[model samples]
Each structure stands twice: as structure tokens, then as C-alpha cells.
Target: MQAKEAAEKLGITQRMLRHYENEGLIEIDRSENGYRRYSESDLRRAGRIRDFIATGFSTREIKSMSACLSDEGAGPCEGGVIKMQEKLEHIERLQADLDARKQAVLDRIEELKQGLAAEPLEL
Candidate 1:
């Protein structure tokens, strides 16, 4: 498969596939004309990589997870655990900040509604 087909099958942009190649997460074979030829194994690896990225794992993290993924989700990759924990902590902090902003917006909306109710003009 070529870059376009691989990208379409994986539901990602070609640029992202190039980035993954540049980051050493996946590799592609070059044809005689230098076009990228993705193998079946490459596609499978790319799918796993995409899944990890969607779950908030960084490229570096995905690179380190090859062992864990190959092991069928068995334990023993301490680094993978540590990286996941860090991502989880970051997500928690982000959720807290978003929650605060949502509450502030709701409060402002309610204040505006009350002000409008108090100053109703004569029909």
C-alpha cells in the first residue's frame, strides 16, 4: 500500500503518517520510484500507534510500548506504566481546569438572565 491508502485505512492524515515515520515509530519501504510502500505488518503497527496516540500517548511513549503491546498486554514494562500514569495525571489536571471554566460560564449566563429579568421594558 502507498501513503494515501495507508493513511485512509488508518483514518489519519498523511502528514501524521510521515511524522510517525520521522519519529521512528513506523517504517515504509520505498519503491523503485521512491514511493512509500507500506506492508501489512506496518499497517498493523500503525494502527496500534494510532490507537495509543488517540488515547493521549505521545510518540515517544508509543515507541516505548512495542514490547508491552507485543506481549499481549502482559505486565513487566515499568516504563510504560510510568508514562501512562503521567498522561493520566495530566488529563486529570486538564479536566479540573475545564470544569472550572464551565462553571464560570454557567454563572455568567445565569447572571445575565437575572439582569434581563429585573430590567424588563414596558411592552
Candidate 2:
């Protein structure tokens, strides 16, 4: 497949594909005429790399994952699983903190309502 075809299939820009190639995440064979040729496996790998990037994996982590992807029969790496778990846990903690802040704001609003009703302001 050509770069344009693969980019269309993956819904990513051609520049992004080239960037991935430059980073050694994906490789393309070159024709004798110098046109880049991508294989089916290369296309698949590009899709996975894009998916990982969309999910917030850092470029370093994506590079680490590319190694695991190179293995023919290997499943997802333990390190990748651990990193995703860590990210999820961090998100959960953030949600909890946000919830606490929201509740505090609601409580403050209710307290203001009560205090305002008791003191009947003169405008």
C-alpha cells in the first residue's frame, strides 16, 4: 500500500505516518523508483500506534510498545498494562478530588441561601 492509502485507511494525516516512520515506529519499503511502499502489517501497526497515541500514551511509551508489537506471537506487554493501570488510577483520583470540590461548592451555596434568608437584606 502507499502512504496515502494507508493514511486514508487509518484516518490519520500522511505527515503523521511519516513522523511515525521517522521515529522508527513504522517502516516502509522503498521502490527502485524511490516511492515508499507499505505492507499490510505496516498499516496495522500504524493503526495501533495511532490508537495508543489517542489514548494518551506518551511517545516514549509508544516506542516501547513498538518493540512488543514487533514480536509475531506476543500479547500486550506487562509494562504497558501496568502503565495503563497507573493512568486509570490517576484519573480516578482526580475524579474523586473534583467530586469533593463540587460538594464543597454546593454546601457553600446552600449555606449562603440559608444565611441570606435569615438576614433579609435591605437594598
Candidate 3:
């Protein structure tokens, strides 16, 4: 497959595919005429990269994860695991903060309602 065809299949722009190649995420073999040749493995890798990107992983992180996942008998790379754990912790903190904010907003609305009910109008 060609770069354009692969990118279309992956639902990404050609430039994004090239950018991933440039970032060492995926590679393409070159023909004698210097045209890029993509194999089935490359398409599978592109799908993995696209999925990771959609999940908020940066290109560099995706590249690292892919390399780790490719290792044989590595018994599961700990780096990606640690990174995901950290992200999960961060998300938990953000959720706690959001819940607090929501409570504050509810309290403020109740206070406003009470004040409005207590006001007397002469007109």
C-alpha cells in the first residue's frame, strides 16, 4: 500500500502518517524508484498509533509504547504502565476538584435564591 492509501484507510491525513514516520513511530520500505511501500504490519501499527493518539497519548509516548510492546519476552514494559497509572491519578484529582466546584456552585445558587425570596419591593 502507498502512504496516501494507508492514511485514508486509517482515517488520518497523509501528513500525519508522514509525521508519525518522522517521529519513528512507523516505518515504510522504499522501492527502487523511492516510493514508499507499506505492508499489512504497517497498517496494523498505524491503527494502534491512531487509537493511542485518540486516547490523548502524544506521538512520542505512542512511539515509546509501540517499541516496548514490540519487544519479545520483555514480560510487559513497566514504563507505559507507570505512565498510565500517573495519568489515572491525575484524572482522579481533577474529578475531585470538579466535584468540589459543583458543590460550591450549588450552594451559591441556593444562597441567591434565598436572598431573592427575602427581598421586599415597594413598587
Candidate 4:
């Protein structure tokens, strides 16, 4: 499959696919004419990378865990495990911060509601 078709199948832009290739996330083949020829495995790998990106993982983070992604249950890779743990910890900290912000917003909304209820003044 070509870059266009593979990107379409992966539900991502062609530029994004190229960027992934450039980031060394997925390896792509070149045709005789020098066009990219993406294979099933490549697309599969792209999908995985896309999913990780959607989950807020950066290319560096994904690259660091590339070893585990390709391992076919051949035991565990310590580097991959450490990278994955770091990613999870980063996500957890972000989530905690976001939750705090959301709670602050909710409290402000409640305060606004109380003030409005006290006096329904003209706009």
C-alpha cells in the first residue's frame, strides 16, 4: 500500500505517517520509483503509534518503548519496562493536575450559582 492508502487506513494524515517514519517509530519501504510502500505490519505499527499519540505519549516516549512493542512474548525487556513506567507516572501526574483544575472550576461554578440565586438582577 502507498502512503496515501496506508494513512487513510490508519485514519491519520500522510504527513503524520511521514513524521512517524522520520521519528523512527515505524519503518517504511521504498518502491522502485522511490515512493513509500507501506505493508500490513507497518500499518499495524502505525496504528499502535497513533493510539499512543492520542493517549498523550510523545514520539520520544514511544520510541523508548519500541522494544517492548515488537517483542512477541519473548520475556520482558527491562528498558521497555522502565520507559513504560515513566510514561505511566507522567500521565498520572498530569491526570492529578487536571483533576485539581476541574475541581476548582466546579467549585467556582457552584459559587457563581449561589451568587446568581441570591439576586437575579438585570443583565
Q: State each candidate's clash count.
A: 0, 0, 0, 0
TM-score of each model, paired residue for residue: 0.74, 0.70, 0.67, 0.74
Q: Residue 105 lDDT in model 1?
A: 100
Model 2, runs deviating above 4 Å: 71-74, 93-123
Worst 10 residues of 1 by lDDT: 69-78
Please provide, for model 2 over 64-98, each residue's C-alpha lDDT reduced to its tens digit, 9 standing for 90 to 100. 76655554514676576777787688778989999
lDDT of 4 by residue, 72-95 (tens): 512475575666677789989999
For model 3, residues 16-83, the per-residue Cα lDDT tens digits are 88888899887789888998888887877777778778866788777667754342313456576776
Model 3 score (lDDT):
0.79
| Runs off by more than 4 Å, candidate 1 | 60-78, 120-123
Cα error of candidate 4 at position 57, Å: 1.1
Task: Give the lDDT of residue 15 in candidate 4.
Answer: 99
lDDT of 4 at 80: 59
Q: Model 3, residue 10: displacement in angstroms?
A: 2.3
Compute the lDDT for candidate 4.
0.83
Q: Which candidate should be chosen as best, given lDDT against the real structure? A: 1
Q: Rank the candidates by TM-score, best first.
A: 1, 4, 2, 3
RMSD of 3: 3.3
- Compute the lDDT of residue 35 as modeled in candidate 4: 99
When sorted by lDDT, best at the front, the candidate numbers are 1, 4, 2, 3
lDDT of 1 by residue, 1-123 (tens): 999999999999999989999998877799999999988778877887888899988888788777654435445665777877888999999999999999999999999999999996999
